[model samples]
Target: MKFTSGPITRPLKMGAYLKVSYNEKRSQVISWEKVNKNDVPTKALAKLQ
Candidate 1:
């Protein structure tokens, strides 16, 4: 998978595999998943948020 600085500030044209987790009553992204495009959901491609 590829890496970008800011998804909220600056979005990319490609898809990414995110490693999301919940801890301390908060949600955070640990790292990128680095998976294939097929592994991602169709809705995620439509909306990157």
Candidate 2:
């Protein structure tokens, strides 16, 4: 998985995997993970993992 900070300037490709964690107190994302050209997790599959 690839991780990044700050905002993205372009659109993500199909099957891109992303995981994000937001910090409500700070009003921002505290953590992020992304895997380009990889399979994105389905709702059910995400829940299982």
Candidate 3:
């Protein structure tokens, strides 16, 4: 990692997903799922800080 401290064992994957549903007042997380990394959109990925 460019700015991470210590040794990195494994690479990070963009597979974690949270399904959200909105209501009249506020939004809530419905469920959490692990989606395929390839299924994720490139624009959604963030650059390392």
Candidate 4:
């Protein structure tokens, strides 16, 4: 994991952020706020199992 700034070709707020995660065979882009939501976690956990 790493944190980097700049090289953004657009404008956004401070809390507006994105996350990219890659496993051995898959990759995904996730929004910070959306993924951290209380409702989202419950729904996601149910689907995972």
Candidate 5:
């Protein structure tokens, strides 16, 4: 699965990262994960291993 940060604009609103897991039919999401930047402090975001 892949995850990406939400829409970001100037002034900073501290968005979030979204990821959706699909089921066998792929008609609906089976599970989801969300991580908010609100608690991570406003800073430059980067990739990690």
Candidate 6:
């Protein structure tokens, strides 16, 4: 999924280069992946500035 450093201002597409994944466990199985970002969308970026 698309990733960003802040809340999404618009819909994002999957398989974005910004997407990240991590591992987690509860009992014996690894949980879902977590996504993060180092940058944000240009529209949102402009707004933030």
Tell me, by lDDT, which candidate is best: 2
lDDT of 5 by residue, 1-49 (tens): 3333345432323455544577877676667666565444344344421
What TM-score does structure 2 among the candidates reach? Answer: 0.41
Each prediction's TM-score versus the true structure = 0.38, 0.41, 0.36, 0.21, 0.33, 0.22
lDDT by residue (1-49, candidate 1, tens digit) is: 4345545544545554554443645544454445667777889767865
Model 3 regions more than 4 Å off: 1-24, 47-49
Q: Candidate 2 residues 1-49, lDDT tens each?
A: 3434546555556555567788999977787678543455577457746
Q: Which structure among the candidates has the greatest TM-score?
A: 2
**Measured by TM-score, how close is model 6 to the native structure?**
0.22
Of candidate 4, the 10-residue stretch with the lowest lDDT total is 28-37
Candidate 1: pairs in clash:
none
Q: How many residue pairs collide in each prediction? A: 0, 1, 0, 0, 0, 0
Cα displacement (angstroms), candidate 5, residue 5, comes to: 18
Worst 10 residues of 1 by lDDT: 1-10
Count of clashes in candidate 6: 0
lDDT for each residue of candidate 6 in 10-44, tens digit (9 for 90 to 100): 55555332323445553332332334434556675
Candidate 1's TM-score = 0.38
Candidate 2 Cα lDDT to native: 0.62
**After aligning candidate 6 to the native by TM-score, how far in Å is the CA of 39 from where it should be?**
3.5
lDDT of each: 0.55, 0.62, 0.43, 0.43, 0.49, 0.43
Where is model 1 more than 4 Å wrong at Cα?
Answer: 1-16, 30-32
Worst 10 residues of 6 by lDDT: 26-35
Over the stretch 1-49, how does candidate 4's per-residue lDDT look in tens digits? 3443435544444443343353645553332332333444566557655
Q: TM-score order of candidates, best first?
A: 2, 1, 3, 5, 6, 4
